[model samples]
Target chain A: MRVLLVDDEEELVATLAERLEMRGITACWVTNHRAALEAVDRERFDIALLDVRLPEMNGLDLKRLIEAKQPTMKFIFLTGHGSEEDFNACSAESGREYYLIKPVQIDVLTAKLHEICAEQGDRQ
Target chain B: MNGSHGKVDTLGLDYFGRMTASISHEIKNGLAIINENAGLLGDLVALTDKGRPLDPARLETIAENIRRRVQHADDIVRRLNQFAHSVSGPVTTVTLREIVESTVALAHRIAAMKGIAFTFSQDDTIKVETIPFILQNMVWICLKNIFQRHDSDTNLTLDFAFQEIETDVVIVMNFSHEIDTAATKAAISEEGKPIILFLKAQIYNDQTNRTIQLRMPKKFID
Candidate 1:
């Protein structure tokens, strides 16, 4: 599956992108919301791994922008704060299963991707 | 002498607090990245011990990233230490380019948070004997103003140039986009006018000699 990863943390994004690519997933990484938006406009991605606290625009706003364009694009938000308010807001907007906290285990992230892909298939 | 002066002091304190907070956050984030990279290397070592070969390229990248972050952290700490000492005295011989670059680095997240592309374009060769902390405060105010007017997708660029006009160095911060009067008013009034007054006084002192012009375009966003 193809994935777009957006996070301001360059190191984290690189590691996560590498791990995903190692597992046979095509991951394109962008450091900010604007670039992510621009990336999506140019290419197609089956899913996006977004960091909640981004540079230009936060992940929540970027999620809305991305979802508006690709309604079927799967999302998994990665956040460092994991505040109750932020979690609750994401849950309300995109369901609780899509949000993951920092230091995310590679297995857990891959599992979530697999689950998202399975759900998408079922929906289709 | 009055509550106004108290508010002015408070505004200075607030600006200092914001700068320190952002500096600390950047340091912490840098350390966090280093920690994660180290952890990944540890994980790789364990995998290798289990007879699974890891990519040498991954190891190299991790080490390189850690080295770069360590250097970044050290630079920040050095700047912070110098800044603290500069706050000790009123005026000092300060490198304008260093202060500008450090300020932009410190304000990167804040500018990015507001969708403002904070930039520095200045001559490193220029050095000035000035009130270090007060000058930083002025730059901070200008940055805050630029961030206030930033749009969602806009990129705000700051250019710092030192011109040798006769016997003086004119430090100019060229910015894009029209200034919002209400935001400027609120920024000055809600906090305190002492900063602006301080800047004006400093400029006025050198008005016949040196000049500092902070210019902004009527409307532009990159």
Candidate 2:
């Protein structure tokens, strides 16, 4: 599956992309909302992994922008802190299944990706 | 004034919480990078078992990256510890420049996130006796306000000068574009009056140059 990772933490995003690539998943990462939007515009990504606390705009807001451009694209939020406010915010959204906390387990993340794609397939 | 003091206390705690959260996020990001590198090493080890030749340079790069991240995390924790100890004494002799530097360090991440260039320059010889925590809170409030109002890519300069005649230190915040000086002054007065009063300081907007000036005495009296 092709995925896009967006976070201001450059090393974290780059390393996560590398790990995902090693696992046979095609992943591309960007460091901010503007670059993320540019990436989405330039390429077709099946899923977008966004950090909840981004530079200028937060992940939730960026997700809306991306969804506007790519209606069928899916999103998973990555947050460093699992505060109740963050959880509630993600849960209130339509795509709640993919909100993962930072320092996430790679295996669990992969499973979630598979589950999301499978659900998408079933809907189609 | 007691009610105002209570408001300053609440705002001080809020600033403390925000700084701690931001620093913790930085440390966490460092750890996340190290974790990924370690995982990559494990992947290489697994590949080696299948007769894939090990690249020593790649291993070295991953190890070096982990070391750099560890140092990054350590620096963040050290700064955080310094910030936590800022409240240890109620009144102490502190260099004005040092306090400004510490405050800038605390707010650096938030500024960077917004792509705002926040810079500060001071005369190292200038000293003051004051409540460091409250001083930091006041400065942080101003910074937080600026970041909230301005968009990304804005440039802000904080210039510090000592006025010998007045025996006061002045911090002038300069912005690239014209801001609502009256509104900013009002906001600072509304939210920060207690601290300003407690510190026996003055803050006003200079409409001529579109700058906000925070003036504090060289020594404060309880």
Candidate number of the best lDDT = 2
Error of 2 at B141 (Å): 1.1
Off by over 4 Å in 2: B1-4, B153-165
* Model 2 per-residue lDDT tens digits across residues B1-222: 246478778888898999999898887788778888898889889888889988999999999999999998898999999889876556888876677778888888888887666555545777788889988888887877767676565555545444433678776777667667767877887778878888888887987788887888878877
Q: lDDT tens string, model 1, B1-222?
A: 236556546666777778777777667667657766876787678778779998999799889999999999898888678767755455556666766666676677787677566455646776656566665666677567657655756565556666545434455655555445445535533343575554442221112322235321111111
Instruction: Tell me the DockQ of each model, to 2 decimals.
Output: 0.30, 0.76
**B-chain TM-score for every candidate:** 0.71, 0.90
Give the poorly placed runs of model 1, Cα more than 4 Å off: A22-26, A38-47, A72-74, A80-124, B1-4, B28-32, B39-58, B81-101, B111-131, B150-156, B162-170, B176-192, B199-222
Q: How many clashing residue pairs appear in each of the predictions shown?
A: 0, 0
Query: Would candidate 2 be rated incorrect, acceptable, medium or high by CAPRI criteria?
Result: medium
Q: Residue B168 lDDT in model 1?
A: 47
RMSD of 2: 2.0
